[model samples]
Target chain A: MGNVPAKESPPNSGGRSRSSTYSGSGGGPFGPNGSSSSARRNTTSSAYHQSGGFLNGIANANDKRSKKTEEKDRLHRKHLLGLIVRYTENVDGGYLAPFGTYKSNLDYNCDIVRGLIMKRRLAPFYTPLQDFDESWTNEELIVILNQLPLHSIETAYSNEEEEDDIDNHKIHKSTNFYRRQEQKAKLKELMLQMKQIQKEEENKYLEIKSSSSVGQRSVELSSNDLLLRLYRNATECPICFLYYPENMNISRCCLQPICTECFVQIKRLDAHPPHDEEHNSRTNNDSEDLPHTLISEPAHCPYCASSEFGVTYEPSLDICTGFGGIKPGKFRSVDESNDDAIASSSTSPSPVSPRKAVKPRRKSSLAINTPGVISIDMIRPDWEAKLASARNKLARKAATASAIHASNLIMNADEDSYSPSDSRRNVGSSALSNVEQRMIEEALRLSLLDEEERRAKERREERK
Target chain B: MAALPKRIIKETERLVSDPVPGITAIPSEENLRYFEVTIEGPSSSPYAEGEFKLELYLPDDYPMCAPKVRFLTRIYHPNIDKLGRICLDVLKDNWSPALQIRTVLLSIQALLGAPNPDDPLANDVAEDWKKDEKRAIEVAREWTAKYAVKS
Candidate 1:
């Protein structure tokens, strides 16, 4: 009975190992070419190297057995990759599905929508501030849906590939040509299933609308009036304590409401500093340190503490995206429909401007690439670079201060460029005090060094 | 200091209006971030009769990070050190933004009722509690009477 020994392949080990690359100055700055896929590839190669070494350790293993074992390992690897692809699609689909669509697919979407509307809870295209559950005429639901941006629903379809597409890219990179073709075919099939489900949900929605007697009587309010009502009954974001319209961005993990302003501000702190093990092993004894590239941890949901903090936003149905039909920086008047809202959505530029008057919701910009969800990292794009530069500036200041004090005898050429007065000015109000403090410390350190050198010379002479 | 965030103001209002049953937290006039807190130890514990004082300060990144809380009243519990620093998960890694000051104070009161010797801040106290349970309880009671008692 020749049993294939299980290969210890942990998925998160890649994330853990890749932490140092982005974490600080150690792995250097992530240039334009350096992305997550390249980092992931490094992990795959390292995994292969480990297995190769394991195989080498078996001294008496015959070539036939080794080749057979390799075949088994390849199959095992293929199985693992398949699981990853399926898992990514499931999670992404689950998030993309309209809130409550997961209960029983397309069948219960209406019930979930009704339940959500009754609760006066925010959902994609179903944000109702006041409960009209008893008076929830099918016409009212249609009116509400029509008024709010139903175009954002189409935005989800475009984003369907999002993370799964990225996973497929990874799968393509990891596998052989045949495996790549196989995985691509499998992904196409999965995508078709998703599309079919989406179509069924749309059909269900149409059927619901056709059955309703919406045509018999005219809907009372215009889109603008509905927007005004939603504004009047705005929900306050807990973090910023600011009142936003009913169609506020919903936290992906806990479904708690958050305004775009506060949601973007929630960033991951650098919890894990860059480890020097890889750097030390790769380089010879060079005293100079590698520049640390700041890697940010995924922000946790403020309400739930669930990691990979992200938000799902459904664009508000009116002239401007929801939250009282107001953008964060630009406050638009209810009646005034201008180009300012479009200009203000500078964070996320969407080619498909649903309406010329409607300013796309900030998250809708992200909706194309990420689909339904926008992670904190995407919310504050290039945050890692900003953080790294900020840390570097602080480190440079500290380095100059220490260099001025410590290396009085052997000053580097760069020391000439550093002016104490310049640094003092940068230090602001405490400049004079800081200079005085540094001067005193410098004097003390110099005197101590001179004294130590003289004592060492005398000791040397005595030994001779 | 920048103007207080509205969330803090709102939280403070709620904390004052609906004060926790056995816990009271009053913000200082000069620094609203700093609070003077007192917790009446849980009933049926060694600290039942004692009134424990604690100082809690919310950092700039409040809610994102846990509040820095320290005991002003010395506690003789395995989880509490002589300096009154507590070894509690909520005060550290297990803290969630969903948790409020009210919830945290409630947790502290609950901690008094149950002293976890397995994870201790004060090693000697934990050892003493583990080795001789009755003696440890008596000592805790004596310390509570000596230090935590309100004159």
Candidate 2:
């Protein structure tokens, strides 16, 4: 079932439209006018500015309100429990104090949570705190994760079936070990503590969910999605519209993100600017003969078109690669072991069991002891016909688009139109899952019936 | 070309199951990547009480890039040109992979309400909008009534 609550009324007709009314407010963090705000902010002593001072007083009052809001935010975070951290290198064995107790590394002016989180001061924060951004060298994160006795430092969890399998249980046990006795002892204690924390978080999630008003507002905090729960706010980068990569780089130009790999890719595109310019100038000429000066042009922000850009901060370590960094066994189960869900689904049938287990017990069980037992002959003919039909459709679309798009650009169907027929091979796997085979058969039979229906219609016309 | 990603399938399913109010986007029978969409003009805008049709296509590199969309029905707006191409930022520069078909449509609907004459796709329409705001709005109402009638 979908995570959303059961529809009381048709969700399609839900009062979402009212909520979607255009606020006319933009998302720029600076101000309403964006870049233009800075220029207006510079005006200090104009003739009209004397009266503007009166307006400034009102602005100061608004600032006081914002300050109150900030204080309220701090109070909210202060209640949350923090780790009592101690530096192992201390000669006198200093007291295990709150992370804020260390004034140098932490920004004491900010609240404990922000100081520990925003500054990326992970060495002192040992309570399995929030996830840090991708740019943090990943070295400190390693130390912090190691100290986290609760979550396993190895063995990343994945989506279902593997946990249920009897064979994997032994493998999981064999991998559990420690290099030192002190570490071993800590693991058991941490495991108990983590279980308690998980229970508390579960309760918190439910408490929030039960309150219908809070449910909509606190979706990120309430969500069990690894990145969502960790970040507690932003995840999707504004520039690429994708989740920020592990080493996330924020462009200072417009405060939008250029995800790590995308940043690198964008730079590569900017690297051959001279060649590109030359290509444009040369018309039909290839770029091979251009004088290559390795001096790359400054890359512009895709959204803002500003050339001044650099990595200001990392948002979060590469979250897209299926919670790959966090050990699977560490944090409590979320929706599913998300890491290898796609990989496992595609390759569900255990290759080793194929030769040994001949009997088909479940409907999904494959019957195979010998090679080539299940031949492709059954579905091949139908697949070929489907491909042929798809090709015909593609050709017709291509001809239409090309003819009409020359001037009156109704469609800009690129010459390299994506052919759905080409994907048949990918779906027609040799190691066909039992479910997949049945689906193919059902489709083949359905197509045959459709063909008969058409033939009958033709025969009826002849009789008439 | 690779097979259509699961993201496309998921987006299509959600569009059908939990459709945006006053908006319907159905994949064409001929091409699943192509969508035939209809949006009722938002109230309080010049385009109100009008049903406008649109053509939206998810190119192969969709989500990474913006979906190719244009108004099929003629519209008289400063931001939308004669060919019905809109000058919305998200449709070009600000396109993010996180945005789905639903969000894009919502943005377009919003654009109808707040026409940015300063940055216009239809220069002549924008000039008309600037010179005579009342007459421009009247023309818009007329165009919506004539060309954007619900089929």
How well does chain A score by TM in each candidate? 0.28, 0.19
Candidate 2 chain A lDDT trough over 10 residues, lowest sum: A169-178
Docking class of 2: incorrect
C-alpha TM-scores of all predictions: 0.42, 0.32
User: How accurately is candidate 2 docked according to DockQ?
Assistant: 0.01
The DockQ of each candidate is 0.07, 0.01
In model 2, where do residues sit more than 4 Å from their true spots? A1-464
Q: Write the per-residue lDDT of candidate 1 for residues A20-97, one digit (tens) a residue.
A: 221222112332124754675564344334344333533333454355445544544433222111101211011112
Badly placed stretches (over 4 Å) of model 1 are A1-227, A273-297, A321-370, A380-464
Candidate 1, residue A159: the lDDT equals 25
Tens-digit per-residue lDDT, B1-151, candidate 1: 3455556777899998999898999987756776788999788999988999887766545665566677888889998886677778887656766677888888989999999997777889999999999999999999999999874
